[model samples]
Target: MTSATRPYGTRERRRSIGSQGESRGGGEERTGPAASEGQEATAILERARAAVDPELRAAVDSLPRRMRRVARYHFGWEHADGTPAAENAGKAIRPALVLAAATALGGPAARAAAVRAAAAVELVHNFTLLHDDVMDRDTTRRHRATAWTVFGDADAILAGDALQARALGMLAEDPHPAAAAAAARLAACVVELCEGQGTDTALEKRAPAEVTLDEVLVMAEAKTGALIGCACAVGALYAGAAPEDVDALDAFGREAGLAFQLIDDVIGIWGDPGHTGKPAGADLAARKKSLPVAAALASGTPAAGELAELYARPHVPEDPDDLDRTALAVERAGGRAWAQDQAADRMSRAMDELARAIPDPESAGGLLSLAEFVTRRST
Candidate 1:
């Protein structure tokens, strides 16, 4: 799998990065490269959450009471009972990208000015998550019951629609000069996201051999990259960045987002369930044609044939042996390495785009940290 880290998720860390950095040798402690990036990214996410939460809460509060209740539960701000619950909402990755991009070009003042836009971007991300959960029939999110399960499918779907509307509404009401442009970009991104998701669903229903790597990559970009790129582009707009610079930042984000998805697919198959929330092999059970599985199916290796046979029917969680064999087949067929290499390549491109806009390494540190966090060496 690619060595990328996670971006969005406020799900509790079963173990801390600090624990990884514990004294491994002499009394002097040291953090590995991955742990260091995790620490920096964690700091950036915390700051983003602090800056964006008030605006986010205010937008949710404006919803009709029923939608508000659903939204609150989805965000982990309240329990199903409507009682206050201080669960982690998310890690604020998209909002952090907004603020980081704004700060990279326009500094602290621009970062402050972009908070509302950041909130709006975050809202749209959660909107996607809600709808995604419904469409995917996902039972767990952020380490708890999905909104659809707790509130019913209709409420979850309606809340997702409300969140999307409120996100645009937030942008429309913003007095900032860049608000209009940001909203336009975000709206287009939402359309791209929907298109990608539709393509993914369509691909999953097809026989595994019918899918192609390129098609899956394009769909992944549309489903995942579009919003992340929009977040950065929106930030660049908020910062009064030149059009070319905005485009560069958008490219940077799109590439990084693709890398993030590649690693996510890897984790879906092999990551520790305690760390990832979702059970191991769940993607295979669902027969989701995620990137690695697609690559494995496309490979001409003998294990590819084995994997295809395994995927002919969904692997039951009760049959851990079958799931394990399927995962091994994917690895043996070079799917894991291919996905990791692609993630690294995408990140390299993202860095090039980032450098095109902000030449100074220091100026790009926050965004860099986030990108590295996204590309963590989990494999």
Candidate 2:
């Protein structure tokens, strides 16, 4: 239903994140148990979450009845109660990047086009999530049944199509020249994302030992970093910033996106079920060729032998005992360590990009913190 008819809690959760989002300062150095002392990214993420508008609730509510069901499932609106609520909704990093770049360029918060641009970025993000679940054959997402699991893949795909259309519509109608430019960049990024996914799927067919770190990095940058960079650049453009300034923000966004994906790789391998909302070693069970798995296979470690066998198997193991065996094989192969190092390197680059992008220490502080936040998150 429409936002007016929806419960305040649902709207608030979808439109704006909870205050706990501000606590993301933990996980600075993931190796240690203790969290980081300083905070920068947490604040920016909080702001982004606050500014995020509930898309399915607002935009999808007006769709045809069949289309609405598809959209609602993706947003966790029509799902049964006691289902898992998403932790942090990914920090609203992309939208925040957009807004932060805008503020750095001296733009006011009242800029309507910038707000719409921010919302558009988030819609694209969720759209990707919907398709990702189906592609991965994932049963659960955000600790609940995935859209494809409940509504079927066809419906979920249609929902993604609708959200994508809405994103373009928002950008086209935007009053600001800069926002429009940024939206165009975002559209280009979507094309790049599709290309990267194609490459990634192709790479999976080849032996992991054949895939180099450089190739993996290329895929990661295109599939994940492009959109993130667009978020920052779009924010800057919306603020009427110069091209050079927007490019710098773009650099920051790309690095930050890489860092974000690297950490995701780690979580996919070793994250706790309670926190990750999935079974431990979930990625390994799925034979996902993520950054870590690719590296370990390239190393030709014994873990690689195990990984190879796991991939060659006719079917996924149904028994928990067999699944755990596969998990140990991946861990033994050095996938975990390799992924962690990649994440650290990506984080360093993200910080470097942020530092160089904005000269003013105060304005850059939030961006800097956001980079750190992406690196250290558990889920």
Candidate 3:
């Protein structure tokens, strides 16, 4: 595939500078080039979570046995090998987005209500992942067996459902109007996520070549972008920011969310096993219609022909050679380059939206740094 096959429209080009056309060498750490930035982001994320309300901790603790156990296991509170260890949990990007958006809008007091809102969003995210694992028949999450793999599918589903309930329950705990709005937004995003997931699953059974870039973007925005935007807007609402600012934050979150998904798609294809906890080219082996693959297939280049032939082959477990061929096919089809460009562009838009949302240099600088962190992260 070549740039000639790319379906990027005028608007997309206008908003992004594209990537620097640099190809990452095999076995290189995803974030090795940006090690310092990753460390900084990791540190900031830890400090923020460390300051979380004790009440929130208690709320998490008060979960029922089954739900709590699954939550603890999924959050890296337990070891992947079934031993005990306090490994780092998720990066908590969504919650951090909430808090940073809140702080940027006003003082911490005004956004105090956002603490619960952030927690609620995080719970909702974990809930989705639990169910997603079951649907995808995924054995692992965060390098550990998924809840459904360890427990029965029924039990995992129930736990996910319970977590969703807890998120809403937490939102409703506060009688404040902002709490109500946040709850409403969260509910809406969940519903949209379900719809997007359905579409994504259906697409897998069909030809990846038939899928367009626009449809992929729609699915990505709905499934992944919605929650991210909700996190930011919820934060702004809890902080009592102006309606205009809240809307701007929503846009910023949406763009950032898009960038996040693009990077995740890249990792799903090319990421190191040590960092991503999944084998390289997992998406290709699964025949999932990820962005890069979708674009390559649609381009109908020689690389696309190779992918078509591979897809037509009998279903079997892919080995290293097959994975390497798949990766090379995608690259020749111009997939990797196009995807990297899109990620960079989306990140730029995210930053621009943030600037418009929060003009304060000091706080906006933090959000900007966070945006850079997201774009540059390897895992």
Candidate 4:
């Protein structure tokens, strides 16, 4: 990209970020919560969302009427009753990665050309969210009632299936040379994601001590890393990058995605309801074996033993107030710190992979900023 349109300055921006994204106050537009996180990264996400929305909306509009309504409501484009509502669609991070990856390797023209591919990726992501909410029994998403709760499980599920089909169909109709390969990779990602979700569900059913850290991490990579990797690889393909560079971008995205999942699991436990759109300590209440909990269980500390006992309790209606002890146990077992360290390490690996793909710091700044933005999400 030209200097006039570049998201970052000449200096490298891949610095250490903690549980929150570093905010340098770069005259950013402050579009929303996403904007509040970081200047350059949020701007890239906002622009990518803007570019992809029309295509996404058009694709949704093509669905059958009831399905269209569900899609619109889930995407936060309309109320459950079908009236216009404020947009609560997510920050568009995945799609932004697509555009940023393309721009890094090719330029603005590549980014522009990849908009359809970006929208396709976002569709696949939302499809998974819709299904995940149902399986996880999650009531909230994007700070609103999840589709399964608002519309019913059957409707929400059918809508999710439709969305997945729509994603592939969108790509099938595209004339871009890269479109076919992108579709194939995305389809394969869905398979891996399903297996990952399956593993997560199975783990939750077992005794806390029965699950291993490696098992959870593997599931996380499949469930989260696969799609993010596909998004970046798709963008690289659109950019006409060499095969090795495309693979490097895929690796970069997978590492960053694992970090994203680590932070998300952290938020699942300790997040503020106002920001996370879910009740605090919800994961603990559910006794879900998140990465932090898994680490704590494996720590062999006295607190780890306490956490194991807490998790072994049978399922009951959750009282959020009852989780303080459990959360404290996990923290005392060093779960929180371990997850944070692992997240930072994963991001370091991500930066390395990114450097392999785009060696010039100037060309790489956009991707680096985004990787930090994802990992740095704070509760």
Model 3, 1-379: lDDT tens per residue?
A: 1122222132343322223123345333244534554566677576557655354455656788766676667777755344556765677888877877887886677556577888888888888998888998889777777878887798789878988898899889877679988898899989988887887877777776567878988889888888888888888898887888888888888887887777777778887667667777778788777888877777768888997777666336635588778878888888777787787767666666676667555776545556566755555
Better model by lDDT, 3 or 4? Answer: 4
Residue 5 of model 2, lDDT score:
34
Q: After superposition, how far is residue 37 of candidate 1 from its true place, in Å?
A: 2.7
- Going through the candidates in the order shown, the clash numbers are 12, 2, 2, 0
> How many residue pairs of model 4 clash at the backbone?
0
* Candidate 4 Cα misplacement greater than 4 A, ranges: 1-16, 21-37, 314-321
TM-score of 4: 0.90
RMSD of each: 5.8, 9.7, 5.2, 5.3
Winning model by TM-score: 1
Q: Can you write out model 2's per-residue Cα lDDT over 116-163, one digit (the tens) per residue? A: 788888888878878877886778877777878877889888888888
- Runs off by more than 4 Å, candidate 3: 1-37, 53-56, 79-84, 175-177, 314-319
In candidate 4, which residue pairs get closer than 3 Å at backbone N, Cα or C atoms, i.e. clash?
none
- Where's the lowest-lDDT run of ten residues in candidate 1? 13-22
Lowest lDDT block of 10, candidate 3: 1-10
- Candidate 4, residues 112-175, lDDT tens digits: the string is 8899999999999999999999998888887899999989999999999999999999999999
lDDT of 1 at 277: 73
What is the Å distance of residue 247 in model 4 from its true position?
0.9
Q: lDDT for model 1, please.
A: 0.84
